[model samples]
Target: MTLSNDTLSELPADVARPGYDRAALTPGIVHIGCGNFHRAHQAVYLDDLFNLGEGHDWALMGAGVRPGDAKMRDAVLAQDGLYSVIELDPAAKSARVIGSMVGFAEVASGNAPLIAAMSQPSVRIVSLTVTEGGYYIDPKTGTFSPTHPDIQADAANPDHPETAFGAIIAALKARRASGVPPFTVMCCDNVPHNGHVTRDAVCGLAELSDPELSAWIKTNVAFPNSMVDRITPATGPRERALAQSFGIEDAAPVTCEPFRQWVMEDNFPAGRPALEKVGVTFTDAVDRFETMKIRILNGGHAIIAYAAGLRDIEYAHEAMADDQIRAYLDKIETTEILPIVPPVPDTDLNDYKQLILSRFSNPEVADTIRRLCHDGSNRQPKFIITSISDCLAQGRDCTGLILESALWCRYCYGTSETGAEIAPNDPNWDRLVAQSKLAKERPAAWLEMSEIYGDLAENAEVVAKFTALLNDVWARGSHSVIADYLTG
Candidate 1:
């Protein structure tokens, strides 16, 4: 028994999956930000555990803290909570059904239901995929932004909160008051030491809201840092057609490049789904893994996204296909960046770099460079800065990373090399663009933002490198500059 779509009376066979009359599993984990990444990665792992019959009692309930997620709510609900995930590779394609999410609470509707969900004792773990910027932490300073409007509003009325941090604190307060056990706060975001950052955000909010509750949360709650990876791009018409061809009526279908990895610190305090049974690695130190992904994969994204966007290129695979861009990325990673990454167990950084290039060149996924380029202010510090710092500290040159950072700032100025207007995306896009406009006049002005660049602004060598690169980028164009840096 299946529902017919209004547009296509007979749905395509490929869109169908093996029908299962599975009962609603108990919601043990409430995942915030049910975006494509979570659907394709974490939820899929949980679903695998469920299918293996180990985590059948531990399901996921989705929650959203923003208005934009209403569409996701509608899509997920329309499909009876079934979604198709197509893993696109150059050599093969595989599909899976993720049935982990059972329900959703729209936070913008009211924080009440969302908070109530968190307050539930059965929900032993709350995971997050809210992206790096969603944490509202200053990337340079590595601290929660107390002055952010959402944080301010949340701070004013601790009992009634809106931000994710505030919402978590409010629910923790409820748990403290009601004698409900504190749930593990697990962060699956890409930021380094995501667990520590999450703890800071939640406790930072709680400190302002209720000092007593803050101390209690610090004592009882657990924040487990996790490293997760899957090159899932935003799904659109092609993915929809792919799902329909697979006979799956998944309205919120997810599509990813044929690569996935999950590494976590085995530190869940309350309880967690049997994810390890489904190929997730639980280790003592995820820092090495985190660095590997951020520098190689994420850093590669930054390297190409700005240049691709500047050249008015669209898809990531398209950019990766360019010999010049591909060479530039390899040089950056292998020569300047990889040297700084701490070693991981039995992993060859060079081999990892090669795999990243292969993943980027997977045309089947069609990951857009524009998507990768979004929120540069929040991304550059995480992706580029540390490599630059490491290189400088070791008396190694950071010309490539410095140029990448400069290009990111230049890209944020809203005009591509072709004069096409880059759509605004960052939280501080307008201000950043305006700053870029004044940057050529006073190239050092943007560096004055201590919150983003920190002491990197005052480092004479960094400043000189950035200034030289910015001059070359503005004068010789991105490709020429990339060639110069790579060959120089």
Candidate 2:
């Protein structure tokens, strides 16, 4: 049976189905970028809330600004916004059909339908999972790019905007003009201080068109920072077949690890669902949690991904099984990254690190090395480079951190150690491959990409260490360099 409202009862008896009345639920939140992570994380939390017969008015209305979102809209709306989330674990696997999304906005040019959906008075929150790079922040300087062509075009045509931030700006303008209060702009992405980043993107774009409106949004809208975690792999034939095994055909099934977490600041002036009742952490110390996760988990991924990719390891768990790669992750986190991470509330950093390692070793999730190493240009700045910068400021050892960056440079070469072509992984793959070729002859050439390396390229100490390490990787194999680092 195809998974939909009518087929909910036809599912296997063991599979959990939403107990709430889907027809009775009303839209209160409009989530942009309805990807696997958002489905496996935020929407699942809402599903749990609805199961308890609460927050029926806070149903999610999915929205998207990108052209690709049209395909997502069609796939989701075909099932009436109902999809299955299959949670995989080492011991057991479970599936649940989430009924939190009530509708999806029609995708159109200039995001007219999306803006209209968000402009509704009922949409008290506009949450986003548009990935870390979606925000128009300069990778080098970590500031909003007001002069980006998309931003410039949006500023020129405020009523008909292109980017997600522009669409949000248009919606907020409609609300303000209609005398309705602005919705809380919540950012659920992985970036540190994500709320501040969202604010900068929204207000920065607003300032280009109208200074008065920018100030209004700055004073009124609430961009709450959040730290969300879930190991959700992109869906493929395997996931679809998993759904089929359960006698339910779902086009957009989300397969994820069983673990999930969301640490958010309680700053929603327009009110929010009582998500605390559903295991969401409403904290004043979100930054502490954000730092712990970004460095240890995300930074840990960077440490393992490139090296594993170079050696032709496919799954993340397989990389963790490799002793040298595992040791590199452990030594780097224990000595370099964790030492600088501040103490999170009621949590032990060592315990957190162990949990991250165990999660990475979840074979059922099948998280790919390619996904982990996909966007180094944007990710390294947030995940790896920031830790390096923090260690340098604190006079801590950053050799392991620098070595991680070198691994990324090597991975950009587009050839695995087994001579398998890696295909372009990053959005800037062409430029990175070009630089990698140049850096082969001159190690300093890789670091010279100031947009990625920033001032670290100019730092004599960093330059010296990076130059030496990268040269070793070229002269010796990646495995030898890693082994020497482990022993040395």
Candidate 2, superposed: residue stretches over 4 Å from native: none
lDDT of model 2, residue 349: 96
- Give the top-scoring candidate (TM-score): 2
- Give the distance in Å from residue 143's predicted Cα in candidate 1 to where it truly belongs: 1.3
Residue-level lDDT for 147 in candidate 2: 79
Alpha-carbon deviation at 174 in model 1, angstroms: 2.2
TM-score, predicted candidate 1 vs. hidden true structure? 0.94
Tell me the spans in candidate 1 whose CA falls farther than 4 Å from its real position: 1-21, 106-109
Q: Write the per-residue lDDT of candidate 1 for residues 1-488, one digit (tens) a residue.
A: 23222322255544333233246477888888999999999887877777666766678888888888778987876765667788896787777666777788765644788899999989898889888888878766788777778888888987778777777887888887898888999998999889999998898878876788888889989998889999988888889877766666567888997678999988877877778888989998788999999998999999988888899999999998899988888889988888988999879999999999988988998998889998777887888887888898899977888888888878877899888999996878998999888776666776766777778888988887788888778888998888887778
Candidate achieving the largest lDDT: 2
lDDT of 2 at 162: 87
lDDT of 1: 0.82
List the pairs of residues colliding in candidate 2: none
